[model samples]
Target: MSDAWQHWAGFMADLAAVLLSLTAAALIPILSVRALRYLTARRNDHQRETLHRIASEAAALAEAAFADGNGPRKLSLAIGYAQEQCAGTGITASADTIRAAIEKAVMDYNAMVKPWSGLPAPGAIAKPKGESYSQ
Candidate 1:
């Protein structure tokens, strides 16, 4: 009876070892993939936020140029300034696309006006020097 019990205990120990090995083999790849996905998502979010900041800077510069009466050169100057700003901050984006988007935003703002506001067509100048809109 003592010898039989010893053999059973050894077998149970071997089984436990095999089960632990299998669990590790199955779990390692799953955990690695999940970690990779989390890192990729974080990188994407950072890139997105950087792009948003660049776009905002571009739009604001274009609006300021317009308000300064830059005429047809407002969008182009804004794009150039935005590209330089992005380069300064190490952000990557297309200058032409940024220019086009700023142009559209300026035009849209110029074309639309609320009826009850009693304000003139402000064009791209959403906030003038003393205007509190931007502040």
Candidate 2:
């Protein structure tokens, strides 16, 4: 009877150990995936911020270039600037991607301004050639 009881106790201990090992093995992949997701989210947030900043700067530069009548040159410079900014921010986007993003930003800005363009101010009146300032 004592021999049978000892065998039963040994079997229970081995079973518990095996269950613990299996549990650990199952948790490993779950934990690894969670960590990878966290890291990827952080990287995405950084890239997003970098892209926003680059788009804004490119728009400003493009506007200046357009105003100066050197649209092509300015657009090229904006692209170069974006590439430099991407490198600085650890973004790996290609030049073409950056250029496209900048162009889209500029186009959106132009479209946004087009609505109120060439209109006079609300309270201002245009003066004729012979109009007198004081009446």
Candidate 3:
């Protein structure tokens, strides 16, 4: 009876080991895939943040450099500047994406800086002497 009990205990131990091994094997791939997806999502988020920052900078620069009446020129300049900056940083973005980012940035900037009157003309904010909005 003692010997039989010892044999049964050994079998149970071996079975537990096998089960643990199988569980680890099955979980490794799943854990790895989840880790990879999390890392990819983080990278994409960082890239998007970088793109938006670059777009905002480009829009501000264009606004400062170009006159208010030169809407087309400002758009072109901002797009070119954003594309150049993105390329320098190894970011790949479409023209439409950059344009949209710039537009959003401009809207945000205007909303923050421009006074909310009853009705104001678009792009008609006058800056005081030595007072810049970009600062």
Listed in order, each prediction's TM-score against the native is: 0.56, 0.65, 0.77
Q: Name the 10 consecutive residues with the lowest summed lDDT in model 1.
A: 107-116
Model 2 steric clash total: 0
Candidate 1: segments with Cα more than 4 A from true spot: 69-72, 88-90, 95-135
Superposition TM-score, candidate 3 onto the true structure: 0.77
| Candidate 3 Cα misplacement greater than 4 A, ranges | 1-6, 117-135
Per-residue lDDT of model 1, residues 1-135, tens digit only = 999999999999999999999999999999999999999899867865665666666666767657767666766777777677768877666766666656665554556644435556667446657766555
| Each model's backbone clash number | 0, 0, 0
lDDT of 3 by residue, 1-135 (tens): 999999999999999999999999999999999999999999888989999999999999999998565999999999999999999998889999999999999999888887575466766767677876565
Q: Which candidate has the highest TM-score of all?
A: 3
Best-first order by TM-score? 3, 2, 1
RMSD of 2: 9.0
Error of 2 at 76 (Å): 0.5
Where does candidate 2 have its weakest 10-residue lDDT segment? Answer: 61-70
